[model samples]
Target: MSSRISTTRVHEAGIETLQKRQVELAGAQERLTSGKRVAKASDDPAAAARAERALAGEMRAQTSERAVEASRTAMSLSETAMGDVVELLQQAREAMVAAGNASYTDNERRGLAEKLTSIRQQLLSVANRTDGAGSFLFGGQGAGSAPFVDAAGGVQYRGIAGERRTEPATDLPLTINGDGVFMTSLTGNGVFQTSAAAGVTQAWIDNGQVSDPSALTGSTYTLQFSIAAGATTYAVLENGLPTAVTAAPYVSGRDITVDGQTFRISGAPASGDQFTVQPSTATLSVFDTLDRAIGQLGTPSRTAAQIAQGNTDALRDLDQSMSQLQGARAAAGEMLVRIDSETGRLADQKLANQSERSRAEDLDMTDAISKFQNLQTGYDAALKSYSMVQRLSLFQYLNT
Candidate 1:
């Protein structure tokens, strides 16, 4: 009577296994259908984290790409503008050479002057160039205004201070500065100052009753000097290589009462030997050695001595201008080459970033699909087994 039968707990533990399989199958199917591995953090926490990092990296790569692109644009503009300047300078040099030849007639010179004026205007245009795309090639960051403007016939830069960043890449960290620093007259002192060149030669010139023309006398040719408006002191090759004259310690302006005659020097006097007051000294618009050459090229029907003076000084100033222009051109060419090299490096970096991002976040379709099919098979088996076990009641047992 106390006989006991071995009884099973009627447990559906297989259901649990089935449920887990179902979850896996659903996830795999989702990945296969949508072509996405980590749609949400709940799907796979580890994958979610990895995806986030990849996404952030991609965004950063894009930012770097944009930055490099901007730098490229700036370099292109800078190169073009500089090229124009070079061509203009070359034309100017040619005109100057023609001026050097004695055969250049007045009519020919007038034509050359017109050509020179056009070139000068073109040069000014080049200097005042702008990207006009909310930036300036010659200017740096924080640009609030145009990079360059004309101030009293000279160029003035009013843009923000910035440095052109080197192409952002994994290679060498280099930079390009487009501040027009090389030949920029305002930034530093070259041979002379940019202010109008007019000064009094207080040193003694020995000539006539004043002193012997070729004597080392301490007597400075004391003459009152005052420069008229729109005039500059181009040449001051004093009798001897006297020291620089300043008006600070002594009276700077020409207001000294020399003897009884108050002879005022409007501009710097040529020499005591040849003294005749003229209205204009030389160039009124420009005040450099080039401008001096223009003054010397005039075939004036005036005095023979005046014509000789013009011819003599013109050639000397042209030589000086050539040296200045050549130096500036060389510097610009060097900078352009640097920018081009930097650009290549930046492009390489962008490509590398793309590869890295793809590796971290891309899905593998073949592997995902195979895993999904296996999970589906396991779930089907569990469901069928659960149904079969449930139907094994006493009624069904009797029939069996």
Candidate 2:
């Protein structure tokens, strides 16, 4: 226990032991106060770095969870909107068929016309559907307003040609074209049209005629049937001339003239009752087709074949229009489905990422508590040894 600079083993050993005790106490206090073993980098640089990384990952995951939920919600809203479009298209198709019925009274036909008009309005509404945030469903990136507008205040599409998509997951993209604009082609004039009555048939004029001939106007041809004779004979005349042709093409509905009386058979034409165009101009509109079909219903003047044929053609056109609309609806449905699937998949990915990040950054309370306890015990032991050794210093007992 002798004291000297280099030779005093007791003093050096005791001093070293006291320093060690102080370090132990510092460590214990830090673990108890902070509830962490590696508070600083120097404490255990490697462990601190790993734990810090894990904790950072947890924070990032928590933050991203909100965004993931938002994406899922957006996709869900888009799908719901698309469902409405399908319903509207179905209604429109039904109205078109009702207008085409041959047995319908004029009043009934007019009612059907009104219903057809309503379908157009509904179609516009479907095109204009918006999300909760007031963004248009089919407006592409510019969701500022309704996607459908109209000429004469009727329904027309105003949306962008392209589609909008959402990114909910990596390598998977979801689309929300709930407005159905993507599949439907332009729907006016050239799209849904009736031929001009005054001019010669386009096919005839195409054969190098100098000028298109004016069509006969305002004629009703009577078709008589004698079941006893088993004969269905219909008389035809163009300006009172029997311009009989074996086959007549009626791209547009026929112009009927019978016994100096004139009635225009204007509607979708049937196969056997096609006639030359009348001098009257061709009427075509979203409303035109339905109005004409309604007007022709239950007209006793027109022949049975003519009536039946007109209605059949009208129905067929309606079916064609529905076909087009259904295409758009189908496309919308496909996109909605794809979007929902991608959104769900993306949600799963986000959840996984969140879990990984949390694992990376979260603190293990149990492990931390155990470490702090061990540090406390070691500190207490070091204090006890320090007290015993420090009290026995060479001059301390003599002074006491």
For residues 1-400, could you state the per-residue lDDT of candidate 1 as single tens digits? 6965432444346566667878888778877887776577886677667667766666665666566556556556666676666566567667766754566667676677677767766766665566667555556554556555656645455655446454444221112233333223221011111111132122221111212233323223222222335232322223333324322122223442222212222323432222221111222222233444454454444233333333333333333333444454465456556546645654565466555545544568888877787888878887888777767778889999
Compute the lDDT of residue 105 as modeled in candidate 1: 69
For each candidate, the alpha-carbon lDDT, in order, equals 0.48, 0.47
When summed lDDT is taken over every stretch of 10 residues in candidate 1, the lowest stretch is 187-196
- What are the TM-scores, per candidate, against the unseen true structure? 0.59, 0.55
* Clash count list over all predictions: 15, 11
The 10-residue segment of model 2 with minimum total lDDT is 201-210
TM-score of 1: 0.59
Runs of candidate 2 exceeding 4 Å displacement: 1-79, 168-371, 393-400
